[model samples]
Target: MMKTAVIYATKTKHSKKLAQAIGLFLDITVQNITENPVLDDVDLLFIVGGIYGGASMPELLAYIKTLEAPMPKYAALVTSCASGSQKQIAVCNILEEKGIKVLDEFVCKGRILFVSATHPNAKDLKAATDFAQKIVAGGLK
Candidate 1:
């Protein structure tokens, strides 16, 4: 079996909730980027975070930068934003530049201040979990 890991950087807990759901469905542990977890021998890594100021958190991007040579073989993204936009192009670029193949990304509405206030709720968690399952079953890495 492939080793998998789920790491998330969240400000309003939307990304955290989704990461936890995916970890639970995959029977893996969910890690907060604040923990500074390192990916070692990870076949598939799930990067979960929320958009702020129309971009991924700086902390997350920095952490991704640190994952150079030891980077996972494959990666997938999960993002949340008030706009419900799936534009984490910056993060995608970094991962690709690190030679980590980005298999896919899943985006959902996230609570950002007053917007998307009801997001990352039960429905969102289910979708995130389903998406993770699909990625695993779809032969990622």
Candidate 2:
């Protein structure tokens, strides 16, 4: 029974919504990255955010830097332009640099500006919840 904390930064609310879905599935509360979340007592942490300018939101990365050394067990979640391939890589590199074991990653669809619209909708939220459930059930193995 791991105590998990979800920290996310979202501009358009898509990432926040995904974090909420995951938090709801895990029975945990979702905290915004701007709120300066702590993970001392948490067994698992979910770093979630939206991609911007071909990378993750600056606020999210900045928050991650404020964490103490020997970072806790964690995973990455993102609502990005594509499938979050680039964002995941960037995040994983940062986490791994701190010797943190990144268990897994989850990516949900997001609406791009004036490009592909209608994302992070009902279906996306459902998928996010389903992904969270599976991740929780598997214990990040």
Candidate 3:
């Protein structure tokens, strides 16, 4: 079996839900980055998080930096954001700098818990899950 790790940072659980969906599809272990994950035995790593303001959570960056494994063949990034911004690119850049090959990047509309009026609903969740399925099926490559 292909070893996969799904690490995510989520404040209100939107990102965590998406990560779980991806994990279900890939049959991998899912973890929260805040809990301190060890990536040594993972063959494929999927980093998932949310974009706050215009960037990803600092903890996610820190976790990425702490990773000690050699670049994996498939590294995927998933983010829950209000819209498609540079956050995904920033994540891709960081992973690339670490010599990790990024295979796909996925983003979906997320609810802003602070600003409850602009939150994503069930439709958005479905869209995100569909995107995750595509990534797992190699459609995002």
Candidate 4:
């Protein structure tokens, strides 16, 4: 059986909620990136974070840099925000530079600060889960 890890960082809990939904769908435990940053044993890795000022969480980026050499073979990126696509390229670039093959990416609307706080609703969570399932079916190689 292939081993998978669902890790994430969040400030307003939007990313955490999304990560948990993916974890439940994938039958994998969700872990905070700060608590469990090492991924030496995971066959497939999914990193999720919220977008702030057009960038993923700084802590997440720092943790990615700390990953032991020889990054995981298959990895996916997930980001959430009002725009969803915000800061995706920056995170994708960081993972690609680490020699990790990014297999897929998912972005969904999240509750923006105090502006538009109604997000990550049923629709968004369903979309995230669907994305994760597709990535799993694509093979973790």
Best by lDDT: 1
- Cα lDDT tens digits, model 2, 41-126, are 56677777777777877777777777795457666554545443445566777777776677777676687765547777788878
Regions more than 4 Å wrong, model 3: 84-86, 113-120, 139-141
Off by over 4 Å in 2: 82-86
What TM-score would you give candidate 1 relative to the actual structure? 0.95
Off by over 4 Å in 1: none
- C-alpha local distance difference test of each model: 0.89, 0.73, 0.73, 0.82
User: lDDT, candidate 4, residue 141?
Assistant: 43
TM-score of each: 0.95, 0.87, 0.80, 0.91
Q: What C-alpha lDDT, on a 0 to 100 scale, does residue 73 get in candidate 2?
A: 69
Worst 10 residues of 1 by lDDT: 111-120
Candidate 3's residue-wise lDDT over 41-138, tens digit each?
A: 56667888888878888788877777675545567887788664435667788888887788777676776645434545666556666766665666
Q: How are the candidates ranked when ordered by lDDT, highest leading?
A: 1, 4, 3, 2
Worst 10 residues of 2 by lDDT: 77-86
Clashing pairs in 4: none
Candidate 4 wrongly placed segments (more than 4 Å): none
RMSD of each: 1.2, 2.1, 2.8, 1.5
State model 1's lDDT: 0.89
| Local accuracy of candidate 1 as per-residue lDDT tens digits, 1-141 | 799999999887888889988998999999999899978889999999988888899999998988856679898899998888856889999999989999999999987668888887899889888889889998963
In model 3, pairs of residues that clash are none
